[model samples]
Structure formats: C-alpha cells, structure tokens
Target: MKKISSNRKKNHLAWTIALVMAAPFACASDVNFSGFLSVGGGMLDDEDAVAYGGYDEEDLTFDRNLLGLQVSGQINEKVTATAQLIARSNNDYEVDAEWAYLSWQANDFVKVRAGRLRTPFYMYSDFLDVGYSYAWITPPQEVYYLPFNNVDGVDVYLTGTLGIFDTSLQAYFGSFTDDLVLSGAPADAETRNQIGLSGTLGKDWWTLRAAYHQADLTIDVTGIPISQTATLGSFVNTLRTFGFNSNADRVLVEEDDVTFAEVGINIDTGRFVAAAEHVEFDPGDAILSKNIREYVMVGVRAGDWLIHLTAAKAKDEATHPETGIPVGQPLPVVGSTNFLIGTLQAIANSQAIERDVLTLGTRWDVTTGTAIKFQIDDIDSPDSVLVDGTVVSGQQKVFSVAVQTVF
Candidate 1:
C-alpha cells in the first residue's frame, strides 16, 4: 500500500540519520547558544470569535519565547555539522538539527549536502527564529495557516551559473507529525511522509522559485467529537425509565487523508521588500467538513513601517452536510416566520455553510527589534440572516493592537 511504503521510507530516513550521527566524529571547538522571548498584550473586538480563549482580549503572554542552542564547527575547510534545540511555550523543547551532515564543495559548478535539514517551504520557514526575525505580532494568520511547517529529513542542494543568470536546485525527503484542530473537536495528528523539488533562477534584482511536492498523510482522530450530543442527563433519564441498562457512550472518530502543495515568490529592491504566497490543502475526510482550504496574500515594507493587506476566505461545505432530509428544494410554509422555527427549518432545509473575511493591518518598528501593530477585520455572511418575514442582517468588526519584540 502507498501508506505502508511512505511509512517505511520515513523510518528508513530516521535510521539512516541516526546511524550517521552515531559515527563518532573529531572533537569540535566551542558550541553556541542563543534565544529570545516576545511577551505581548492584545485586545480583540469580540472574544466570541476565537475558537478557544487561550488568549484574552487583553493579556500578556510568553507565547513567542524561543530558546535555541546550536553546535557547529568545521570538519576541514569544507565540511560542517550543525544542530539546534527549539523550545516551546510550556518549557519543553524539540531537537531541531536545522542543518547536520556533510557538505562537499566538489567544484565551481556543483555542491551537495546530506543529513537532516530544513526544506525551504516558505520565505520565513528558513528563519523561524524569534530573536532574529521581525514581527512582535505574529505574522498574519490568514497566510501562515499551516500549524507546523517542518520536516525531519535529508536534502540535496545544487548551485551553479547559467551564463548571466544563477541557479539553485533543491530536493528533499522526510516526515513530520503535528496536531491540527479545525473545528471544535479534539486535536488530531497529521503524520506526513513526503518528497519535493524546488529551484530558484535569476540575475540581479529579480529571482523566482518554483517547487513541486507530494506528501502522504494519515490523520488520527480517535478522540475527536463527531456530532453534537444532546443533553446527557436527558438521555440517561429516558434510558433508565425504559428499564434499559446501557453504558451510553458518546464519542466519534474519523480517520483522514491529506495532501498539500504551494508556490510563492519574493523580491527586494533597496528600500523595499515584497512577497506573496498561495497555498492549498486537501484534508480528505479528516475532521468534519473542510475538504479544501486555499488562500493568498501579499505584503510590502517601506522605511521603518511595514504595510500589509491580506484577504482570505475558507468554506467548509460539510458543516451541515446532511440534515437527514430529502434534497431537492425548499419546503413552502405558510405563517409568521418564527425565529426558533425558522432556525430549525434552516437547519433542516439545507446544510449550513459560511464564507466571509476581509483583513487589513499595519506595523511600525518603534525600536531596533521591537514593533507595534494594529489590525482590523470585517466579517460577513449571507446565510446569517434569519427568515423573519424579511431578511435580518448581521455583521461584525474586529480590531486588535499588540506590541512584539525579541531579546
């Protein structure tokens, strides 16, 4: 099976890397370590919009503290090994050997590296360090949608010249595991085994990158909730009165298959740096409704200020996929439109769906590595209106401000 094969490949990659690391090496000099923390306070226009209230409308948190220690020293003049430990919010950490292995500068026309490393999935992925990167406020959530974007793997990079233009070729193989919670269900883990190829070509002020990737993912959702449960006490009472003894269990689980692919571009000319990305994800039968998610965003920097404008929309057609009713058309009902009755009808008449989002924001660097950001978003939905003999309108606006920095 494809899944079996992918799993095997990942296991093999891990074993191979472990063996390479185990082969004792010559003693290297001093190791290096550094880290930073970004504590922020923010306010949201409406707290109800958040799926969970881990963050407050106004509170300070070390949600962005990153502790990293790297060890790197040269083997001869051309070979090196580097490893890092990335810490999380709960004071826990993971070994992120961002770059480990041997590099051979074969010649003026070719170069190669082998070991565990990072694949250039996005512009910022290569520099996810909190202390070094700009942004006290996290990057826009619309585009930075992927919860975890790294792979434990091996990579090969080739660099050369094509007349007046320069080029680089990169290929990689690896696997990654991380939890994703799209709906109100318990988190599920997505394990990915993948391989990809990317290339960059350009002259001076301009360069472009194109990449193709294929990943096999298995989603484990055993503890996640499937459908809404009615009142527990009511169900238990009815069962007891009927002289039935049953261990009423209410839990749902569904496995999922996923595949993701993306392409993006970046450009910088003296006083300005511009970038944009477009990505798509297919969560086949994963959580509940979302079968596909797609979005794109563009941003620019000028002076000490960064102005970013983004628009993104996601539609989960499966939210109310089946209402246990025959599908054809609306049922005609004569009488005053009752809010409760209409709401029930809407639930029964058609599957509930939503599409809405518009975002705009700006950030200014007030100091060397600290900045302030303000953002506003407007939400709209067509089906939000109730059938009250007339259309009932509903809309909400969200505004937020925060300070971010790394030390």
Candidate 2:
C-alpha cells in the first residue's frame, strides 16, 4: 500500500475541514457539529528513550496534539449518520477519517451500524483518541499500542436493563488494511475474517467488561514476505537443499490466525476512580510472538483537581521456528553456518520483552469542558532493544503537559 505523503495529508485535512464547516449550512436542520482538541508537549530524559515515548532528548515536541471534528445528523426517527475527521501533529497535521457510519435503532433495546467503525479491543477503544474523555494525559501504552484500531464492516449492539444492572452486548465483523509502525518502520499489514464479541455490565459506580476478537493477519516485513528475509531465507534454503521442504515451509510467514482477549473493570465515584484491564494476544505464526499486557490506575479527586497513579506492563513470549534445528545440528558450513543459527536464535530470544512503566499524573479541571494535566513516567525495559540495536537499561523518565478540551 502506498503511504500518504505529509503534504497530501495536509491538503486532505484542509478540504475535510472546509466540508465539515459547511455541513450545518448544507443540512440546515437536525445536524450537529462538535470537536475536541488536545495540545501537548513533552521530552524524554534520555535520548535512547525516544523509542519508548516518541520524544527527543530535552526537546519538547507537540506530538500528542490533535484536533477532531464530528458531524452527526438525524436521518429519520430511527436512523442517524455520523462522520469524524482528525488531524494529528505527529502525522504532520495529516487528517484522517476516524469514523463514518450509519446507525439504525431497531428498537430501544437494539441498534445496528455499518461502515467504518472503531474496533472494540479494550475498555477505552471506542474513545482512544479523545484525550478529554479520560483523566490520564494518555492511555497506557503497554495495552494500547495494537497496530490496528478500526475496521470496515458492520456491527450489532444490544443494550437493556437486567434486574439492577445495565447490560450491553456487541458483535462485529470487519476487515482492516493499513500501514503500521512495527519495529520503528512502516509495514504493510492487513487483517481479514475479523470478528469479535464484547459485553459490559454496569450498575451504580462500577462496571465490568470483556471482549474476544480473532482475525487472519498478514504483515509484510521489509516490503517482502517474512519468509524471504536474508537470514530466514538462507536457513530455509539450506533445509530445502537437505530435502526438508516441509521444515522450510514450517518457518514461512503465510496467512496466520491471531486472537485477542481482554477483560476490565472500573469503579468511578464522584471523588474516587479505579480501573484495571488485562489483554492477551496470540499470534499463531512463527514470525510473530504472543504477548500479554495489563495496567491498573487509581485516582482521587480533590475539589477541581484529580491525582492519579498508574502501572502497566507488557511481556512478549519467545517464539522459535518449527524447523527442528537442534542446538548441535550439523551445518552445511561448519563454523559460519553454526554462528548464523546461533545469532538468529539470539535475535528471536531478544524479541521477548518484559517491560513496565509507572506513571504519576494530575488533572486539573480548568472549566466544565477543559482540563490541564501534567505527568511523569518512569519506564523500565532492560531486555528490550531500541531500533538502533542498542539495549535499553536502567530506568528513563519522561515529563509531559497538556490541555484538553471539548466543544
């Protein structure tokens, strides 16, 4: 897929803003327009930490700043149309369509929607980009860095009261295609046969939710199939020369099944708030690793100010090719091939990441619709390596401040 250039993205955003600004005039009635904005700047204590926070050493960048516009119109008594566009500083002020969907209220208990929609992958998936909706300056990155966020398809949602609890259920089917940032580089990625189910139950100030999603995934590494990597390709070819075609195929990166499961709970009273979520990813492929992510946040409100603490972690399980190459297996080239295999195994093992972050933040309500926040994060990733192949050691600190508001 061709990536959109920054210049083109800017032009697209301008055109989109013009169209949205004229929407009310064109519709004349029953059309509503609103927007949200977040302007932020931050710097990392260590230059090597840039990979961890997207911040440069001692340089404040407004990478987190963003603007979103939403337009919704009631098409009839039972139908409505909504569209949202967002421009982000990190993307060079690129505008992107976050959502464009048509919804129908079958009755008070059920609703259906079609077109592009947010994937219900986590507790805050639906409002991931809307910083004003959440107390934290940003969502926990450990669990929120999934490559795909939205899908193109349809969904059915049902909500009602169950005794003293308010309950909701949702099911969706969709496909997604995008250029994703992987290992600090852009990769062409696609997901098909995407299906998911989610449910939530809430009463009073507490809520619980769970979701399950599965899809067939394909990712092009270095603009080529993963099986074509120089290292992997050489290994596979060597096996093939030894009449091990099946073994070679076992190490290939063909279409693979991937699954994601998540569960979360939250307690939100007027003065106190607590939330935690756990998610697991099983990428059933030799080229991809399975991982688990979790986070917990607690906060207390004092007058117009809220203080919060969060801890989050992610662990990637090591994966090995199924080619049955033993540690002492004889190589075609005695010393060189042995070294090659050893290096490859070490690389695979290094992909296993055990990292954690601790954050302290405060949100001050400047007005009913606006908030200002400051946060500091302590990140630890001893086993993880940066894009430049440098191992990250000890702990790094990042400081950030932002103002978020909704119109």
Candidate 3:
C-alpha cells in the first residue's frame, strides 16, 4: 500500500535477526531453511507518464529484485518458532522481517500465534510480499493499497467444516509504527487500536473470502503554521476559534478511525480460472477522500504455459466538509477564511483516486521450481490526481519481465 522511505533506521532489533541469531543454539536438525528469489526489470514507454510499480520512462531498473529466507524450528511438542528475512533491492538491500512469530497448537482445530504477524486484511495478505505466490508480476495497486503489511500483535485462528464448505476464521489486534508514503511524501506514521477479522470458505475449485479491519491512524507531516498549531491542525483550531466547531470536527485526522472492507471470489478449473474482488476504504473525518477499488481477472492454462488478462480500477468519494467560511473575504496579514477552508478542500480532492489499468500477461514454467513471466500494462486515468498541489499525467504503458524461483 505504501513505499518505504530510504532513510529508515538500520540498527533496530528486528525479530528476524534475533530468531536467526539464536538458531545456532537450537538443534541443527530442528531448524529448517527455505528461501525465494525474484529478479525483475521494467520500463515505461511514454513521456510525461506517471510511474507504476516503480517503473518509469527515465531509466530501466531492477527495483523488483528481492530475496527472502525463512527458518522454522520446533521449540516443544506444542510450540514452534518461524521467521522470514527479506532483502529488497529498492530498499538498498536492507534486511527486513516480514514475518516473525511463535505458533502454539492448542488443539487440532485451534491455533494461537503471537509476536509479529501479517495483517490479514486481504485474501493475499499472508503472501503479499512473495511475488511467486501470485500469478501477476505485481498485484493490482487499486485493490492492494495499504501501507502497513505486518503488525506487532497476536491472533487466533480456527479451522473446521460447515456442511460442504471448509471454513477458517482469523481475528487479530495489533499496532504498527513506521514511515508511511502519504501523498507521495514520507512521513512518520502510526496505527493503533488496530483490529481485524477475516474468514474464508472453500470447496472444490471455488473459494470465498471476506474481511474487515479498522484502526486509528496518525501521520505526522508537520509544516508552516496557519496559526498557533501546525498547518493541518491550524485549520481545525481556526474553525473552532471562529465558533464554527462543526466544520472543524469534519476534517480532523488526529487518531481518526479508518476502516477497510473487502470481498473476493475465485473459481479455477485445471485449464481455466476467474477471480474478482471489491474493496472500500473509509477515513473518518480525515482530509482524504473515501476510496473504492476492484479488479477482475481471467486466465487459461495449457500444459506449462498460461495466459491471463486483468482489469483493475479505483474510484474516490470526497468527504470534504463545507467550512461555511465566506469565500474571498480578505483578512489582516493572513489570506481569507475561505483560503483556509479551500486548503482543506484541496487536500481532500488531492487524494481522490481515479485509475483504470488493463493488463495482458503470460507465464512459462521453465523448471520444477522456477518460472519466467512477461507482462504489458496499459493504464488510463480519466481523471488526474494532485500531488503536493501539482497536477501530473496518470497514464503510462509498462512492459516488464521477471524470473522467480523458490528453493
């Protein structure tokens, strides 16, 4: 959902490193090792086009290069520890832990996990970082938009059968703090009181998934003061100072409630496949618009070769509040009250999402655990988006190829 900034701290105590450093003390036979790697490159073909998935017309780069290693060790009869350490080329090869947790098998049908875990907000959340786990070189950004992928938390998972459907349920609560890419800028951000619930039912070649997640989000992007408070906050404070409290309440983002909801259906037979998902995001009282995104895909497989086509789109709904301030009324030293209100409105409108992308791709299995893929994506954004008050082209055509292997 978000790109990590390059200036992240490097000396933090990551659970992946902690677990791996302690691996030597455990019995060598108790620990198992597995890994995956992907090396990819792509280029955009048009001038004045926005970048997609980090590919641009300026230069062809291997930002898609990534390698990850996983280790699991049995701690006891009922407990086990697992960790995954990943190095991404885009992050300057800095190792990060996508998963590090201890699982306790309470019974045949129930399990508990604690420590760092993936946020189960999407159908592919568990393997979101693993390119080999999915058919597309990259999942649709419209639907796969979220910045926090992992959380420090605990979760309970239960599995059972309901008549003809195999059912699994997951419930979790956690917190996440890191640098977030908001409005194309890196900012210090945090999410708290984050809770999520997801369930899946499957039988035969058909599967169904639904999930809901909500959290209190805060992004610190401080700047010039419109008054005594910060830029964003001064608007609310000024509104309150002028006794227009209702308007102020509509645009406050400090610890505001944000939610995500999604539903997905998939069907697959040996030679044919189809899948679709719909997702919505609501940021309560924030200066960002509500967003809805969806995608549909169909594919066919013949022998070791497969072809697929995908269509994805995203739309935004504005939640801008009419501050009721008179327009263009001049003030002393500071613009007009309308300028303050218009700034807030522009902030909301700037984040409006309007994107549609059509993708044609193919995959070939070169060996038992290795595959090669090529894809072309035609993106069309009928409506332009604003970034830092600047308008730019949103259409880009990208061509890419990748080699993925799991060992």
Candidate 4:
C-alpha cells in the first residue's frame, strides 16, 4: 500500500482516471474498474506539541482522506492482470500505483503472480489499502508499521483442503527500494534478495496463520543528529580513518540482514469476532534496535452496529554493540577508547520505539458498500512521557470519524 507522508500536494486525479479509462484497451477480456474512498477528519484532544496518527490539537486534519481505484481483467481462463492506484490527502493527493501485476492460474489449487506486488509480510497485506473490507478504522498500527510495502518480484500461492481443515500457503521473492523515515530522519532505504513464506489453516470458526520473511537491508540517512558534529555514516568513516575497521563495520547498516516472524489467530462465531497478531523484527549484526509488536481485538455484533475494543503494544531494545576498545585505554588522537565506545553505543541505540494503545470503536453498516465509523484512542508511551512537550503522560487522546464506501 501507499502512504501520504510529509507534505506534497498534487492533482493526480486525471492521471488515475486515465489509467482506469484505458484498462479495457490493455486487455482483451472484460475489464472491471472499482473504487473505494475514506473521507474523514481527526484531532488529538490534547498535546499540542506532539502528534499521533497525523492528528494534532491545533486543528482538525483530514489526513485519513484516501481514495483507491482498482482495475482487473481476465486475460484468459488461466491468467489475469490487476492494477490499483491510490491518492491521499496527507500526501497532498499525489497518486501512486499500489499494485500492478499479472497472475497465472496453474490449476485448481495453484496460482502465481509477478510484477510490482504488495509485500505479504502481514495477514491483511493483500487488502491493507482497502478501507471498506476490514473492521478497524485502521489495522493495528503497531503491527502494520512495516518499513516498506511494495516489492517487484513474484509469489506463488497454493490452496486446498486437508481433511477437516482448509489450508493456504504462499512463498515469494522480491526486492524493494524506497524512501523511509528512520528515527525521525529521512533516508534512502533498500531491501534486496527478499524471501518470504506463509501458511494458513482454518477449521470451523477459527483460523491460524504464520509467516517468515527476511532480507538484507541498507539505510542512508543524511546529516542525522545522532552525532552532534557529524552524521553517523561520516563518523563511521572517521573511525575507519583511524584504522578502527572492526569498530566502523559494527556501526554501519550496510547490507545488514533483517528478519520478521508473525503468528496470528482469528475467530468468528456468528455474533462475535476476535483476532490477535504478534510479530517480531530482528536485525542481525545491525546497529538498529529490534522490535516486538502485537495487538488484540474483540467485537460483538448488535443489529447494524459492531462495537469493538483493541489493545496494541510495541517495544524495542536499543542495540549496544561492544566496540572492543576498553574504557580508559589509550587512543591515537583527541578521542579516547571510552569516547569511541560511547559514539558506537550512541549510534546503535538511537532508534528506540515504545508505545501502548487502547481503542474503543463502533462501526455501523448504514447500507451495502458503505459504512460509518467513530473511534476513541488512548496512547501511553514511555517515549511520550515528555518533559517539555506540554502533555502529561495520561492526557494523550485522539478522536476520529470516517465514512467509507466502495463503488
């Protein structure tokens, strides 16, 4: 899926519409064009100096205003092609292609797709951008905050029945390049040689899912403030200049291996629904911190309204790499052994994330293909236990409402 990050405004409606209008000509088969929209506004009830989920106390923000258009066509009995375009207010309406791929049906239970594809790192990844398909105003942010979403590659899927259970399996290979925000700094990010495998099993009212994905990642942030005098990258170079090759290598994020593992469960019993997903991100030999994120949700249906409660938590441990240089040991220049150790530790521990959130929400299906939703979110963060941010630890709250429709 695509995101409207930072601030850039554009009128890409014409571009998006042109793609949809030309879908028929691109395929010999009948074309299907569908669209979805989420129009809404949200604001933080307090905490002027800080922001959460694009909401601030200064004013009402429509950052959640999002639009998506999907086009698909059956190329043949065994093949199909799909493309999706998305625009968002936070991105200033600059349109982006969220998905563009061709799929091949090999048999009754096997399928394959290749091209620019959504990364299936999570359970809801296939429809992450489709607001009308899911129950939450948004998926649990903690688990969904993957560094990147789309990759250019291929995936294979298999589905069948196993005794009393239905089963599905997927494996994919791809690479992605994009801009990322790491530790509040903009950086060029790349993930290469990605491989992922996932499986799901369902029996009656419950389903279980598990997945694993891994890649070599590199990040280049310009002029980060981790070092008061130089960027971390530059500091690493300086360490190399002093023949501290081993120390320099330990602090760099060049082609570092990273892995993600997930397990989730979902249950639906006519009037009740429950789901939970847990994920862990591990960065091996990388100075970046590691994270564990998870969320649990439960809801009940009464007439047209589905009321729910969700709790999410994310925690990370700062990586503190040993520099080999002992404290009080002599150094070749103005910096001491302890100074080198401190800088290495500082760079390693710079990226730390910790948050806990509780949410209460209601969704009303006013009519087919449309819905209205309202939600209240309370956030408690160890990082947000601020000193000068003008917000007390217990005062962080946000309220939001949205109307979503698919047509």
Task: Report, for every candidate in turn, its global Cα lDDT versus the true structure.
Answer: 0.49, 0.77, 0.79, 0.78
> Looking at candidate 2, what is the lDDT of residue 245?
66
Model 1 over residues 355-403: C-alpha lDDT tens digits? 4556676778878867777766665655343334444343445555555
lDDT tens per residue, model 3, 305-342: 88999999988887767657677877654567776677
Error of 2 at 336 (Å): 7.1
Model 1: colliding residue pairs: 43-57, 136-404
Clashing residue pairs found in predicted model 3: 1-146
lDDT of candidate 2 over 317-407, digit per residue (tens): 8676543555555656544334445644554565566779999999999998899999999988775565567875547889999999999
RMSD values for the candidates in order, in angstroms, are 9.3, 4.1, 3.4, 3.9
So what's the TM-score on candidate 1? 0.63
Worst 10-residue lDDT window, candidate 3: 5-14
1 or 3, which is superior by lDDT?
3
Give lDDT tens digits, candidate 4, residues 1-407.
12326222121332343355456447565778899999988888776434677676646776788899888887778877777889887777877776777789999999998877888788888888777777788888888988687777799999999999999999999887776666556777789999999999999899999999999988775445564466777777777776778767767777989999999998888699899999998988777778799999999999888899999998877776655666776777745777777777766655656889899999899999999999988888754434244544544788888998999
TM-score per prediction, in order, is 0.63, 0.87, 0.89, 0.89
Please identify model 2 stretches exceeding 4 Å from their true place.
1-28, 48-50, 222-253, 333-344, 383-391
For candidate 1, the clash count comes to: 2
- Which is better, 1 or 2, measured by lDDT? 2
User: With candidate 1 superimposed using the best TM-score fit, by how many Å does residue 7's alpha carbon deviate from the native?
Assistant: 18
**Residue-level error in angstroms, candidate 1, position 53:** 10
- TM-score (C-alpha) between model 2 and the true structure: 0.87
Candidate 3's C-alpha runs over 4 A off are 6-17, 20-25, 223-252, 324-330, 383-392
Which rank order by TM-score, best down to worst? 3, 4, 2, 1
